[model samples]
Target: MEGFQQQFIISVFIILLGYFFKRTKILKESDGQTIARIVFNITLPALVLVTFNQMEITLPLVSLIVIAILFGLVAAAAGFFVFRSADTDLKGMAIMMMPGVNVGLFAFPLVEAIWGREGIQYFGMFDVGNAVIVFGLCFFIASYFANGSSKFYLRETVSPLLRSIPFLTYMFVVALNIFDFHLPTFLLDTAEIISGANMPLSLLLLGLYLNFSFEKSWFPLIGKYLAVKYGTGLVLGLSLFWLFSDYPMLANTVLIGFILPTSTTAVVYAIRYRYNAKIAGTIVNITIILSFLLIWVLASFVAYH
Candidate 1:
């Protein structure tokens, strides 16, 4: 817990520094965009390549993936019903946006910081299902609503998944691990070097892209979305905490996983589908802030315990 507190405090400082730079115009929004692209295209893949290759797959790791996916499906179903009264676009968008966790950019860095490679393994495995929802289900929902058609093609749904560099790296590493083949040491070292940039750049990218501007009309819906997103996470996280009290690693993983902010990937979906990207962007920003506070509180409780 002391380790978590110290690391988290440093992490928050870096994030706030990013926000400060953007606010002061020391770094433009375009700079943030460029940094984000580098993260997604380069650094993140390196991190995934390094970590996924190194993880020792086990039943518990597999279970974490299963639980994450199940939680997402349940959340999506609930979101559909909750937003049933909205118009088709808003309804579909809300449903798609509400469920998936942001493990890559948000969870990984913090987990790696607090719990090191062990925590990364837990969350990375959990992201197997998360990638499914983010690159598959969420994309389809947004596309369906944007086009005003329910027609779903298997190719359309999966193309983005296959196209993702990090996704491909994950699959490649999984296959290698399963077959008992290891990456060359030189290659692994290169990946480690690149991945070292992932955490700071990612947090700074979040700050650079942070936006507070939104239509006043979006307020109520955003409020409801946050409640469903964080509230559901709270209930599920607390239950897992109690159930896995003896298993600190699993318990803490579940708790932190629940509080991770909305995926920046959602904004990508919003843009591609010509949906309300602004609202999606706003949610991303807000959730990051909310997740920090929530995680801090959770960490405090853990320390006291």
Candidate 2:
């Protein structure tokens, strides 16, 4: 319990340190992009490789993948219904933001801090399904609404996932795990060294991207979007917790996974699809703040209990 509290404090402090760097002009917010790239292409993949190298594939782990996909689908459906009366642009933005969770960048640091390698293994499996939703389903919805066309392009949807190094790492490691194969010791050692940097770098990158600016005019829409996103998450996450209470780690992972901030891809998709990027950014920022607080409170409560 003390260890968890200490790590959590360190994580929060590191984030604030990054924010401090940004505010003090020591590191520009845009620099986060470069860090993000490094984290995604290098540190993150390294972490994935090391953590999942020897992980055993089981029904529950596989179930997490399925659950993540289903959860996104449900959230997307809820967004569609909730924003049915809104304009195409607003509707598209809402729906796009709904399905994906920022597990990689947002959840990894805290999860690593709290549960160490064990937590990473669980969320790692869950992220496999999240990657599908983020790259596959979210992209399709963004494109569909952006062009107002029903056309589906296979390459367009799969291209992003294919290009994702971390996602590829997940696939590579999972395949190896299934065949009961292990990478060379030297390779694992190198990956372990690189993976050590993922947690701090991710937290710092998040701090750099944190922004509190948003138009007051969009408050109502943001409110509606958050309400639907988190409201659905709470209901589904808690229910999953109840069902999976026998597996505390899986249950906690699911609960935290559901409440994670809107994926950063939301803003990227909004920009690509010509939706309102500012609104998307604002919603994501707010979610980051909200999720940080909620996770802290919830984790602390669970720790004490």
Candidate 3:
């Protein structure tokens, strides 16, 4: 318990330090883009490769991929129903925001801190499904609404997934595991070294991206969005946790994964599709703050219990 608490404190402090740096002009918010690129393209992929290399492929573990996809689908459906009366642009924004969780940037660092490789392995599989939703499904929703066209562009939908480094890394490592093939020791050692940076970099990037400014008018919409997202998350997440209580780690993973913040990609899609980027950024930021607090509470409960 002491160890967990200490690690959590350190993680929060690193995040604050990143925010502090940003405030002091030591690192601008724009620097977050470069940091994000490094984290996603380099550190994160290294961590995934190293973690998944050690993980054994199992029927139950693979099922997490399906669970993540289904969870995203359910959330997307809820968003559609809840925002049925909104304007086309807002509806598109809401739908795209609903489906994906910020597992890579937000959850991975904390999960690594608390549960180490074991936790990563679980979220790793969950992330595979999440990547599909983020790169494929969410993008499709944004594009569909943006163009207001009946046509579904298969190439555009599929291209992002193919180009994503982390997604490709997940597929590569999982395939290697399935084939019972191991990377040479030297490669694994190099990957392990690079993977060490993932946690700190990710936490710091979170801090760099933090912003509190938003139009006051967006408050009601943001509130409703949060209620819908987290409300659905709590209902489904807790129910699944109850069912999987026999497997404590798996249950915790599902609970945590379900409630994670809206993906940073939500803002990206908003910018791409010309859907009120300021409001989208505001929504994502708030979710990060709320999810961080919620995860801390959950961690405290887990520790004491």
Candidate 4:
């Protein structure tokens, strides 16, 4: 636990430091989503594809990680319903729990920095598993909100890659890597530049979104969403950590996984489908704050034992 406490203290500092930078104008206000788009569409896909192509794997943990994320996503959805606090207005809240990582910004570098490339390899291993589940289920949520409202359209299968730029971006990268294609140096360099801008910029964009809230009429019910975000994240993540502790690979696994909340990926998708974009942003903002403490606790646990 000593290792957990020390690393947790440090991790919490970093997380809060981000919040401070956001509040103090150090992060500025403009260019949040543009950077997010760049990272999602360009930077992340490149880093992931390059890394996946480049890394040597002795263990095929990608499937395992995917299973784990799917389990978590299911549980998160269950929490949203069983807790039954916010279902009446679930239109805005469901997107927050979309399956994915804080990859690129939080998990990608954080895992690499903490556990090195091996960690990222494992992270990549699990990404597709989470992606399929999250994106697929997100539509279900969208359809729920569409609710005979004439806004919902159900696809018989996965939509075209063009339908999902972020997913396609990584899917494209992964395909190129698996096929052993070499990218032009100029393209690689461009990816590095855009991805480099994802973190600080995303944080500030978060700050701007966090500034908005439901109208005064909606404040009381906001707690239901807050409850789902923090409560499910902490309880589910920690529970998984404890259950998996006997497995050696559990080393750095949970910390590496929950680095950030459900990403704005859901928000972007929700907006495209017209479910409730602002609600998605609110969940992202609030979840990011809750995660500061939860991830620190989880990270400390991993760092130590």
* Top of the candidates by lDDT: 2
**Candidate 3: worst 10 consecutive residues by lDDT?**
54-63
lDDT of 3 by residue, 195-247 (tens): 99999999999999999998889988898899999999989988998898888
In candidate 2, position 79 carries an lDDT of 95
Candidate 3 local lDDT, residue 65: 95
What is candidate 1's local distance difference test score?
0.83
Candidate 2 regions exceeding 4 Å error are: none
lDDT of 2 at 156: 88
TM-score of each: 0.93, 0.98, 0.97, 0.70
Q: What's the distance in Å from true for residue 14, model 3?
A: 0.6
Which candidate would rank higher by TM-score, 2 or 4? 2
TM-score of 3: 0.97
TM-score of 2: 0.98
**How far is 134's C-alpha from truth in model 1 (Å)?**
0.8
260 Cα displacement, candidate 1 (Å): 1.6
The candidates, ranked best first by lDDT, are 2, 3, 1, 4
Candidate 1 Cα outliers beyond 4 Å, as residue runs = 303-305
**Tens-digit lDDT track for model 2 on 70-165?**
999999999999999999999988998999999999999899888888889899999999999999899999998889998999998889989999
Better of 1 and 4 by lDDT: 1
